[model samples]
Target: MLPPLKALPVFEAVARLNSFSRAATELNVSQSAISHQIRVLEDYLGESLFQRQGRYLALTQEGKNYLDVVSSSLSHIARASNQIRGEEDTKIRIAVYSSFAVCWLMPRLSDLQHKHPNLDITITMTHGSPELSDKTADCFITTDTEKRGFEYQLLYKETLFPVCSHAFYEQIKNTLNVTSDELSKRLKDEPELLENFPLITSNGIYNEYTEDWRSWFLERGIPLSNNIKFHKFSHLILAYEAAKYSLGIALVNDYMFSDKDTHSALVRLPSHRIYTNDHFFFSYKTSRRNETAIKALKQWILNEASSLNTLA
Candidate 1:
């Protein structure tokens, strides 16, 4: 027997988005209307589809299995409708870190536009890793490797290093009396040099507390000073900006420091790079993996990440 066709859209939207209010907004209906349709669908299926815990909504195991079928079938139906109506543009929404969007993806976005004029993109910048749900975005630039019912493409491995403003670099480059490569070696070998400047830190790196500097120092066999001065910021971007203004040397990574931005203002101290278990992956729901918008963006982003990873 066929499920209630009309109720399926309501269930899919509520399930994918994980919010009755948001599903109502997307469906242009009332929240009560969403709940009613969900009840109807669950009753027809003779099983519970959603588990409610206070203000949050989550899918049951059966609900998750059913959604894979429903979302894919609905997408194909919508694709057929778009084709019949001669639709030209497809919008792809992405969730990414604020720093990566500014430093890497922003400048190169136009190139993606040039390559695929029929594709529209919307970006939702995030401070930390967001949960994998349609409400987060249709696509995610995330470090999460869990693949329950999602597809992933490896973007780049996490690479850690420190940077200071070119202004700050000039002040110490001659004092150190060493080539850039040799300076990097010194930064790794000479822990005492840190006494000359303060360390800028961020809690946003790898969702850990001040591990950015700690990892770089420990990874390079340099010990953190007991009495070193430190400055902290809420986000990695803030720390990067502070470094650009010569506030101090901020521990950063290649993902945060890209060649495409106005990065000439910053100097890379490549003495040591801490590579962690973290690696960025471009992820999307497996059911929608074949969508034109998702396919195009995945290929272009993979190419871009490949170029940089190859260079490094």
Candidate 2:
């Protein structure tokens, strides 16, 4: 038999927060009620779950062990309850950066809707890397590598390559009598050949300032030349435009190119493609990973990511 199942939430809340008053506030009950519920659990278990130390509460050894089981069991119960209530009726709120929304996600959303007609998703666009918390949104597509309570599934690592306008692409072809594939091979034979043209890159888009260019050159053991003409833009989109309009070659990410085949003016140089530690991930709460709504969304995102990566 269950030992006062009604008190589980109150116990979990108080144990997690380590404060009876905070748990009472969270559970929307009086502090006395919180005490009564905890006392009921202690009476049932015949063991102290928490010990007080100067103005704060700490979980005992038994409480620590019990918390792990309690948390998992409660999560399972919550997920099951949501499933019974038709979780699909609620929209899954996903937060992403604006650039991703514009360059990658927007194009593929139609396909997603067609494929999973029942899966409802609402997008929230953020300017910078989103500050994720319980209140932020249901899921996040971000470059944040930090592991929190959330489960992060890497969508793709950012692939850095150079691109230029058709006119510039032709000029390079005429001048060198070779395509980018050939040029990439030639660069390995003579690294100095890299200095022949202007280079464009963006600022503040990576972990370090202009790590895109640095990483590309560093990966190939090519020394960064100080004499190379550099055109710096405040953002990657501006740099992409610079490269699109015959503004020499720009170091760009795969997402910026989205579907490279579609861009007539833009030509990808596909140089030893530098895959960076910087990645875009599909993240959600781990506790809800098993819920049907979350499972469907996770599978859809994984499928889409696989398709996009394969196409790229």
lDDT of candidate model 1 versus the reference: 0.81
Residue by residue across 161-264, what tens digits does model 2's lDDT show? 77888788788767888876787687667645656887787775663445677777888787788788877787777888889888888877666675545745
Flag regions of model 2 displaced more than 4 Å: 1-87, 145-147, 177-185, 207-210, 258-265, 307-312
- lDDT against the true structure, per candidate, is 0.81, 0.76
Q: Which candidate number maximizes TM-score?
A: 1
What RMSD value applies to candidate 2?
A: 7.2
Candidate 2 lands at a TM-score of 0.65
Candidate 1: worst-modelled 10 consecutive residues by lDDT? 255-264
Cα-based lDDT at residue 210, candidate 2: 55
Which 10 consecutive positions of candidate 2 have the poorest summed lDDT? Answer: 203-212
